[model samples]
Target: MLARVKLEKGCKSRGIKLSGALAAAGLIAAHSTKDLSDHQREKYAVVTLIDCRSILDPVLSSDYMGFYHSAILNTHDVSGGENLWDLAKRCYTAYSNAKNNNKHFTDMGDLNFLMCKAIENPGLTPSSSLRTAFISVFEDPVTDDTNEMHGEVGVEDYVGCSSVHGVGPSVAIFDTIRDGRLDCACVYPSPLHSRDQMQKLIDDMKKILVDGCANGESES
Candidate 1:
C-alpha cells in the first residue's frame, strides 16, 4: 500500500537528486531480465503508487477504511550497465511531470477503465496474465516504521507487503525506512520468478545502493 526509502549523503547530478524508490525501481527493472546484455537496452514500466489521503479533496485520515491511493506509471530504457542515479532522475522527472499535471487524479478513471477491460478480456494484458507494469513502488509511505515500536509490540523480523497475485506488476516493492535502514518486501508471482532469481536481483540492488553510498555514485 505504501513505500519508503532512505537516502544518505544525497548526490546531485544535473541538479536532480536520487530518491530511494526511484533508484531502486529503475535498478530492479534494468536488471530484471538477464536475457539482455550490457550492450542491449530494454524498456521497463514502473508504477508508483501515491497515497492520496492528504491530497484528496475531502482529505481522508490515516484511519480511513478504504484504499485511497493513485498510481503513476512511467517507462524507461535500461541496460545492464545503467547508472542508478541517472535512471532514478529519469524516473523522478517522469513522475513529477505526471504529478504536476495532476495525472494521478486525472488518470485514475482511465486506469480503472483499462483495468476493467483487462479483467473482462485477459488478452488485453501481457501474456494474458494481467501484468501491467514490471515494477511497483510507493511515492511516499504514510508512516515510518521503527525498531523501538516493533520491540514494544513484541514483533520480530517481519515483512509488511501487498500481494500482487491478481492484477499488478511482476514485482511489488513495499519499502520502509526503519531505524535509518531501508527494509523492503518484494512480492512476485510464484513459479514465474524463482526464489533464487529474486534473491539474486535483491542482492544486486542492495550492492548497487551500498556501492553508490560508498563511492558517492552508482558503479553500474
Candidate 2:
C-alpha cells in the first residue's frame, strides 16, 4: 500500500496568481489628479474610520483641515513635516521624549520645536512659512484603536504595512494623503494587497467620518 501511494505521488497544483490583484491595487492607489485644471473642483466625500470623538471638539472647534478651502493652501504648503518619514520621526521623538520625561509636550509646541530643529541644520534655511506648514499637519486620534474592528479595520488595521517595515503610521498617512484626497492620510491599517481591502478601508473610513459629522451636528 505504501509503494502504491508513493507511485501515485502528489497531484501537481497550479498556483493562483496574486500579481494581477497587486498590480490592479497599485493602479488604484496611484490614481492621479494632474488632469484637473486650476479652478477645477470635484466633490469628494470625507471619510475617517478612527473614533475621533474627543479630538473632534478640538479639531472641529477650529477649521480642522481648513487649508483645503483656501487657494494658497495646498498639500505641500500645509503638511508640516517634509515627507512621511520625517513626520514619523518627529512623532516618535516627541512621543519618546514625553514618555521618558513624564511631561506632556503639546502637539503644536512639539511641532514647532521640530520645525525649528529641522531648519537649524546648515544649508537648510527653509522659510518660516514652510516650517509652520509642517507644524500644522493634521492630528491623529489619540485614543487607542488597536482593538476596534469595522469592515476589515481593527487597531492593528490602522497600522499600515509600512509600519511593519519600520515606517510609522504617521508617515504612511503623510505620503498617502499627499495625493490630494482630504481623507487620504489616515492612521489605520491599509493592507493594500488587493482592491477589495483598499475599498473596505475607504468605506470604513467614510462610515466613521459620516458618523462623526452627524454627532457633531447633533451636539451643535
Candidate 3:
C-alpha cells in the first residue's frame, strides 16, 4: 500500500496514472532479464490496456458496459538501461496522446475489419503464439471503516474470485488492492509454464515496484 501510494503520487506529479507506472516497470523488468537475448527483447510487444468509458459519448457510455477498453501497444525500443521515471513518462504520454486524439474510437472500425480478415484468413494474423500480458487494477482497498459489515465480520478474511480458461494468452496478471495490500494473481497456461519461474517473475515485479517507489521518494 505504501508503495502504491508513493507510485500514485509520483505518477500524479508527471500527469500519469498508477497503471502506466506499473506497465513501465513491468516492461523494464521483462526486458532486463538475462535469459532473453537482444533479438528476443526487440520482438516483445507490450500492450497497455486503457479504459475508455470516460471518453465516450453519454449515450454510448450508458449503453455499453462490456469490454470497452482498448490496448496501447508499445513497440518502441527498450534495449538500453533507462530510468523508470522516463519510461513511465513515455508510456503515459503515448496513451494520453492516443486518447486525446480519439484513436480508441476512431480505430475501432479498422480493428473490426482486421479481426474479420484474420478470422477469414488465419494466416494473415501475425502470430498464433501466446504471450504474457500485464494488467493492474488498483481499487479502493478494503478496510474496517469501509466495510459495510462493520466489526461483525472480518474484512481481511474476504477473498476475491475469478475464472480462468486454458485458451488465450499464456499468462496474465490480475492485480488488486485489499486491506491496503496489493494482491496479484498470475494466471498461466498450466503445465506449459514452470511454477518456479512464474513465482520468480511475480517476485521480481514486486521488487521492481517497491524499489521504484523508494527511489522516487529519495529523489523527491
Candidate 4:
C-alpha cells in the first residue's frame, strides 16, 4: 500500500498511499496517549488487502470476481513521537519485504489456522474479544462515479460496507475515490469499542495529519 512515490517521477521522497501503511501509522500515533512515556513502545498490527485480479499470473478482468483480495499483516512497534514520514517508510518497507517474499500466499495456511484457533479460543485475542488487528485497509482504492448504467438505475451515489460486529479488526476501512474525492466507510464492533473511544481516536488521527502537514518537517 505504500504507493505514493513514483521513482520515475524523481520524487526522492517517501510516499504514502490512501490504503497503505501511512494510514496505519497515523492511527497508531493517535492511539498513543500523551501520558505514555517516550521510552514506551506499543505493538500494533494492521492488515492490508490486495486485489489479485491484476497480479495473477494470467491476469483476469475486473468483472471476474470471486474473493480475489488477499491480505498482508504487519506489526509495528511505536514509541510515540516518531516522524510520520519515517514511520510510513518503515511500515511500507516491512510490507514490501513481506510482499516480495510472497508472505500473503505462503502465510495463508498459518493465517487460517490462527483464525480458526481464535474462533475456538477467544482468549487468543485482546480481552477475549476476537480482535485480530487494529486496522484493516485495502492495498488499492476503487475509483468510479455514477455512469449510464447507474443513471438507468437512478443511483446518484453509493457506498460499500460490511458488518464487522463479529470477529474482525478494530476498524475496517473501505476507501474509494469518486469524482476525484476520497471517501471511506469505517466499521467497528460497538459496545466492545465504544463510539466515544473510536471518535476520540479518529479526532486525534485528524490532528496528527493536520499537524504533520502544517509543520512540514520530517527526518531526512
- Distance from true position, residue 34, model 2, in Å? 37
Provide the overall lDDT of each model, using Cα atoms, as 2-decimal numbers.
Answer: 0.68, 0.28, 0.59, 0.69
Error of 2 at 167 (Å): 5.4
Candidate 1 has a TM-score of 0.82
- Candidate 2 lDDT over 1-220, as tens digits, reads 3321211121001121111111112222222212544344332111111223334434543324323211011121112112222222333343334434533323436544654565564234332222222111222312222243443553233332122321112112322221122223333333423456545645543443344334434543
- TM-score order of candidates, best first? 4, 1, 3, 2
- In the range 135-219, model 4's lDDT, one tens digit per residue, is 8888777776655578799987678866534567887878776565556677778778888887777667656654554444332
lDDT per residue, candidate 1, 187-206, as tens digits?
Answer: 88877778988787777766
Q: What is the lDDT of candidate 3?
A: 0.59
Kindly list the per-residue Cα lDDT of model 3 for residues 1-220, writing each as its tens digit: 6766776788888887765666666667767755655555443444555556656666355235475567554444565465677877877677678767877677768755754565566555345323323333221221223445644676445444343542233345556565565666666656666898667666776787788778888888
Model 4 worst lDDT run, 10 consecutive residues: 1-10
Alpha-carbon shift of residue 13 in model 3 (angstroms): 2.0
Q: Candidate 1, which segments miss by more than 4 Å at Cα?
A: 1-6, 11-29, 62-65, 217-220
lDDT of 2 at 115: 44
Where is the poorest 10-residue window by lDDT in model 3? 136-145
